[model samples]
Target: MFIQSFLLLLAISFLSAGRVPRPEERIIGGQNIEIEQAPWQVSLQVNGEHICGGSIYSNDIIITAAHCLYEKERRLEAKDFLIRVGSSLWNSKGTLVKVAAIRSHENYNSTNFTKDIAVMRLSEPLNFTDKVKNIPLAERNPAPGTVAMVSGWGATSIYPKHSYPVHLQGVDVPILTVDQFSISAGSNGQTACYRDSGGPLVVAQQLVGVVSSGYKYCDGPTQFISVSDERSWLLNAIASIKL
Candidate 1:
């Protein structure tokens, strides 16, 4: 009996060491997060309205999807953009920074979400606070089936009526192979929807992908612009900026 109990304890220890709880799963079905869990998250706004989500790449730079700029009918101007950092509450909490400039991936495809990435220079550096921080870009892609978390203030429902969550929402999802991601979205019905664009797809708390595009009405396979694929361009863009 003593030997059997020791072996059971050892097995439990190994399992605990192998599995780290993802706080995003604390809510049932990944519902509204209670704390400012993802400090790097930012809300991209146009005229005081939340348009999409973004990631705080640096004190003065934010990363998001390029397609977000074209969502409006009018041609985008720098003055039209604003970045809200350091807050999880989408209503009215966070430092608002005016956009200094916008740079989109040169190869960004307007038709599809291919190479759909962008960097926005803040007019002034953000005041890093407890609620505001920067997340590191992923150095390498994890093997397929790695679980990742996507957080945003996007509308929760697609069918009945679209509406944004009162607070930021976090959902845990498995990283499907590129092909499988596409097939799953097309076949099954897991996807990111409106207002989720430009949000970060994080693995183990590291930025790995940018919400690019997906099936319409928020029900389909969503495509993420792989950060690993755009690292070169992102580095160049950051270096070229005067700030």
Candidate 2:
């Protein structure tokens, strides 16, 4: 009985922290980046609250994680969503826009979080400028050992009580693998907590990954949904949506 109780407690301890950590989990071990460096970054919000991160694809489209669209297994409507772009802060300084539509992969599985990518159309096109630009999607995944960066407004601390930096943060992660339709990074201790789900993983100015999952603790491997793996679906989803 004592052993059973101890094991349960241990599991709970491991499950705590990070907005998304674990199969569902988020970022840490990152530093503030110049806001101008992330013109394509966005904060995915739910009913006026910042919940996840995303990347701009064009004047009207954004890419994020499929898991960010649900609450208690109920998918949210377009009316319940908005995005903040062109700012380093998730709460303030970015232009806010309404979400017009969202399309996740048909085979997306909540249980294992497979095919965790989603594309969204904005109610209106963004007025592009130096502060707001689109990120190009990668046609191929980077090889293992390449350093990529991920950005988001997520926890900076690994503790149960998370420290969320007001400004955007980024961390350099070394790729561990890009196999079976996913990209995995971190665990050598020099990674940024993936930050909020749906943020961009960039390499050479191309969007190679979408923040997907990680362990509850920050000092473990982080998984991302490979943009290259879903390129066909992404292009189709983008083309089908009308602004």
Predicted model with the maximum TM-score: 2
Candidate 1 lDDT for residue 146: 76
- Which digits, one per residue and each the tens of the lDDT, describe model 2 over residues 123-226? 99999987799999999999999999888886666445555677888888889998877999876344444246788899999999988776555556667899
Pairs clashing within candidate 1: 185-221
Question: Per-model C-alpha lDDT, please?
Answer: 0.67, 0.77
Q: How many clashes does each candidate structure show, in the order listed?
A: 1, 6
Model 2: residue 176 alpha-carbon error in angstroms = 0.6
lDDT, model 2, position 38 = 79
Off by over 4 Å in 1: 1-29, 179-190
TM-score for each candidate, following the candidate numbering: 0.81, 0.87
